[model samples]
Target: MSLEVKNLSLKIGAKKLLSDINFKLETNEVVAILGPNGAGKSTLFKVLSGEHRHYEGRVILEGKDLKSWKASDVAKLLGVLPQSSALAFPFSVSEVINLGRLPHSTGRVLDHQIITEAMSKADVSHLAGALYPSLSGGEKQRVQLARVLTQIWQKSDLGERYLLLDEPTSALDLPHQHQTLSLARDLAKEGAGVLAILHDLNLAAQYADRIILLSEGLCVAQGDVKTVLTPQQIESLYGIKVTVMSHPEHHYPLVIAS
Candidate 1:
């Protein structure tokens, strides 16, 4: 499956947040959305996930309009991991992960299988019976990722699963951050389109096949890391002087600053 956004714009009250946004996500591609704080990155994620409806342009999935797809249908096709997900009541990690099966048919066997697979992929299988509220920040993030993985992991139609992650590693430690991104890259390698909104420039450069730089409600740059992470562009977008260097192993652009 693919995602295409054309001339997209959004506003709230009297402020325009995103303007004329245009991008396409191809199958097996990992695209990172990078921007400064309050640059409408979250809003764009909402639009992509179909959580926000009112917009000026189109969000097309596989050539069909996003709005035309039913909520259940969309849930099966795409899984969204937001910056923060909270549960009012204390639910067991297993219970939380099982919630991902809501979009599927009611069957205990299938639910158990999906939850088990998701937990294994997220490396949270040992914490399955623990209370969600009692877990550490990184643990909770991993549990949430398991939930999303369960939601989209259908063996028969696996190629259509699209993972939308917004700052998935914000609350995680260094190890967990790499773990989460590595899982995302693996998913993309398996023919899933993974779109992530990330703040860590180095992580984005290392994992993302392409980067989309948004600044002041516009997509200022979109391409490989070297072309998109230039010193001038970094300074212009975030008011920071960044030095770009090539990674010794991967040869990808690496960002550093004084």
Candidate 2:
């Protein structure tokens, strides 16, 4: 029901990418990772998704070590959406979304139902018959999101699932940006752990239940939005002077350039 990372560290050749990172992502919460360029946010994600295993600590999922779980089992439990995905072959958006059903044993009727629901959730249903390669960057991103969502679609069967999103809203428009994060929040509300890597501080503050800020491969601060989005901390992290205030609508901490 929780992802526990303890004393995690990673190195590539002679350079250290992450050092002594620690955090727990529990079900029913959205945690956002924030940092400047080269702050090791992506590296941390690689470790969590089991793509980088040469680290120096433990990643426990549902009371079991991540290394102990089989790759197929992990796939059923965690869904990942990378920053960019490419499709060399011409595949319809619906076809691409159907690929997520590969892991499940559902019948054709059930699969279609799940695919339709996922596309609807991602706001990509209109792009169903469109060729994936012909779509815009934002459109493709949404389709990929639908695929990931479909991968973990049978929420009731997959106990304590997790969604790892790497800048999922980077190519999305204003409304879709909010929509994507809102969907992630909804997933968290459904008792799943959601972890996202975000560049926009305001968006992170608005959607994340907690924030973890990194600098030069080390964790500098981690806590609720109010505690982590302080002006002094943000200024120190991103090297920019900024004003922090309560959002006019939601009253969450809002950051603006000074």
Native-referenced Cα lDDT, model 2: 0.93
Full-model lDDT for every candidate: 0.90, 0.93
lDDT tens string, model 2, 76-184?
A: 8899999999897999999999998888887999999999999999999999999999999999999999999998876645368899999999999999999999999
Candidate RMSDs in order: 1.5, 1.0
| Candidate 2 accuracy as TM-score | 0.97
Which segments of model 2 are wrong by more than 4 Å?
A: 156-158
Report the lDDT tens digits of candidate 1 across residue range 142-231.
999999998888733423778999999999999889999999999988878999999999999999999999988899999987789888
Give the 10-residue window scoring lowest on summed lDDT in candidate 2: 151-160
